[model samples]
Target: MQIDFSRSIVDIVLDHGNSIPDRTALIFDQGDGAQSSLTYAELATRITQLAGALSARGLAGRRIALLFSAGTDFALALLACLAAGGVAIPLAPVGRRKARLQNILNMLGDIRPDCILLDDSMAALFGDELSAALAVGPVRYLEFAALAAEPHPFAALTLRPDQLAVLQFTSGTTSNPKGVMISHGNIIANEAMIQVAFGHDQDSHFVGWVPHYHDQGLFGNILQPLFLGSTCVITSPAAFINRPMFWLQLITRYGAHTSGGPNFGYDLCVDFATRRGMPDDLDLSGWRVAFNGAERVRPGTLDRFAECFADAGFDRRAFLPCYGLAESTLVTIAVPPQSDPIVKSYDSRALAAGRAEESKDREGVLELACCGPAMAGAEARIVDPATGAALPDGAVGEIWLRGPHITAGYIDNPAATEASFGRLDEGAPFLRTGDLGFAAAEGFFIVSRLKDLIIVRGRNHAPSDVEQIWSELSGTVGQASAAAVEIEMGDTQHIVLIAEMKRDDARALSDEKVQEMAGRLRAMAMERLELAVTDLVLVSASTIPRTTSGKVQRKQAGRMLMDGELTVLAMAGPLAQAFGPSEQGASAAGQSALR
Candidate 1:
């Protein structure tokens, strides 16, 4: 009954029944504080029978897609696919992107899996042969539970360490997504490193509403628990977005020791308290690792969150600043859990000049939070993006990493792989994070986004520079009113602006005054920066899409502008044609979580 780390984890499940069988490996919460449990023994027996089922149907080594709701079934289906040596293409909730179930089918069709595993509800809607034909050609549908009932074929197969275990799709910078090829070795290494860095163990538990298909949720919330023999409670992100308190309640209910998300969750929770009467004295003392990452790590967001939850007994020390990308398998560096998050303030102009210059000027000073140091064996460096020369300490440059946990490259993107991961001036090869940050005397802090900048006419401009302008505006919380992205229209760079309206100003001022304010802001941007902002989107307060930590989802906002759904100023001429008034906020219909 020895657990084989090198073989299919399904094989390892065979050992679960012999030892620690009754221990709960997963806790499924339905977001309303209701819960269900699945022990290691129960999960192992089900997966074993499922592997037997898939083998009975000749599904071994065949590709299968899992379009599922977050539950024990979702986890079981994925493990079953792997136990039988079938490739699992998981599709989880991602906001608005998978609105139409047909789009889900199309993405799955691209993979052309032999069969699809779906929840009973999803099967009712998209599983009909007629809809399946219309959805994306003929892909057979199978209920998740059906697999567990199949007779035991019991032809156990072992996976080579290099064989593909999970073929996760990464939302690359490009419009089209690319599959991130993860081997058995990559998955195994990430879990082991995560177990050590994050202190995951059998006694530990994870509660997340993060999208399961994304690397962060899949690896951190789902697989990390599986590898460490702990309990993971996962729910759909849409559920939490609908009720932000659902996250806290889950932690309180499950006694979850660990939970984290992007900055948006913190903002949303605060906004909820202001708008609706949320429970005080919420009792989050059981929370151990309450870190936040995924995008910009905001100091104010953390402070505000700690202050908000202080009455609820949430410990401020549990808040940690961590950083990672899909390229590195979710985490590159994590500040020791509950460490005082470091914030490095810098000069705006000098930083825009491709030189990270530290400044103490209280006015207009930008604070970038520390993402801690590298994990055990991982190495990190800050290099000048232009010449690849290693930058001195205190200088902001592109973040590069080399580690056992890092993936080699995008599956088939040879050009990008070559451009991103390669030999650095420091002897060995490294993967460029395409992120702008400095290794502070304290450790890693991403100051600005490398590729998220814009060159208007001839001046190098950072979107954070514009975002900072919105920050100083009276009555605007840090990210309440700013997302700047340059849209390419012919040869020149056309700036697309998405800003949040101050509630007081929106309520008190006339529509004309609001328009005037927006116009003045645009004019100020042009005059100060010498850039023509083609469109201005004045959204209602608290509408901007930011990670749980405060990084703006500029690409998503840009997509909204490109679709003419973002309404800022009047749609006039080119601006009117591009920024149509769609008026869909964060929680819109047809929106599902990320895949």
Candidate 2:
């Protein structure tokens, strides 16, 4: 169970390649019926060749940016960087759009990488534009074919565990992304932790469609399998988006023991199964440790998914709710393997006041699923965000983390790093997670982000609680909904609800019907959560802004609502009806709810 922290990841790969040269290391199912396989020896040779090529170009101890569009090329490029003693920086692929192109350029500016790896296909896709942009920069661009240019002596390369391995960029949902510096030691520790938590052995298999750019994709889909010396079936992110069922089918086909994504993925599967129905002859008895993380884990989604797939041999207990961030090297806490995820409801008002009192009233409560306890090498604690004081169990506060899995710090941002890494007791290095949660007898329960919590009359309310209220309308709520603070009528902030309409129903329903539905939603919010809704906007799908990983960007949606960027299909209630200038126009009861 102990990971040799003194050894680099490459050492593990070498041992596997030498011990099981003929064993399958990776299986690529492009989701188009095209498949490819790589053995341990074959993959090791390719990685060593590419590493040698990178070393020939003076990339050793320097940063190497990977710009491939996923598949064998992407995986090999990452391994090559580590093998060649270069820090790996996986970048978003180049696109013609000005914004995406600028993002790549901005990343390049920050990393100033010695070389950038571009697969043959992507090199041809961008052609002149990509070549011209790189021509002005000092960095070198190497094609995938260049990996064959006289395989250098990888055996002579020196590898260090404390050296930089990866620069994982934080998900830029709330702010501009910053690169987190992950040392080789961090990767080794986290990978071992994951192997233990998920029970991944050499015989275990993995199937996932997560994009290689995200932390979940890199750590959960790619690195963990390699660390475990197991076979992993790969597919593109577009594949899952195009057909959510294909992800599960791949698991069934490959007899994969582990596969999962964010809570939204499970919801997507349930939605698709409802419309398309489960495929005939599908079997999932072998599937285990269905991890749910990188976002809030919804218990309702878990229940719906289990019920929907129960006929296909799916087990509800396979659902493993977890909590993690890129800063902690992917996973900090995960539900122990083979255990059913725990869900509990708390008094909504008491939760707002930073207490975890069990709800007595069934109608007005906030339900949250536990992400389980801290991982093997890590410790998690709740602390007061304002005073850095440790909070007792059953009290909500910011979650602080300390472990070998934790990153060194943010790259080139001393002030931000210093502000993020604060001490709790006896000067222990704890990374301030900026997440609001509470620890109880069961485990850690994530309530919401500290910055994202909505405050009205000094009581904090989770936006998810309000969003879930509207989403309960089921047929009316589409793919996503957002509740945000709308600062209106001179500094007074009221909760603004923006929902996406189902595309099919939006086309058939009249404006009157939409307005009636919104009225119902407004009434339900008032009755259930004891909150007054100022304005409700029902717009078409894609109206509510979301991050690349499908998380609702509440701040961005709020900004879009204020700027009139979203196409408003229907609107209900006055924008400032809750706090209008004329006291006669406002309801006395609604005013009391606001207070």
In model 1, the number of clashes is 20
Write one digit per residue (lDDT tens) for candidate 2, span 287-378: 88899988888878888888899889999889888899989989998888888889998888788888998875777677789999998878
Best by TM-score: 2
Lowest lDDT sum, 10 consecutive residues, model 1, at: 586-595
Query: Any idea what lDDT model 1 has?
Result: 0.69
Angstrom error of the Cα, residue 481, model 2: value is 4.7
Model 1 C-alpha lDDT per residue in residues 1-595, reported as the tens digit of each score:
1223564455555566568788788777765657777888988877778888887887887778888766778788888888888878876433353355656756765766788778776666556742446455556667876666566856667777667767777654423565666766667766676666777677788888877777788888887777777778888777787888878888887788888887667777876876786775477998989768776777777877888788788888887778887777778688887566667777655555656566787644566777888877678999888888888877768898987666767665788778888778655479888888777667887766677777654446667656655555533545536887876654445576677765455456665665665566566655444445665556666656644223467776776655445544332224444333434432232122210
- Which candidate number maximizes lDDT? 2
Q: Residue 389 in model 2: shift from native, Å?
A: 0.7
TM-score of each: 0.85, 0.93
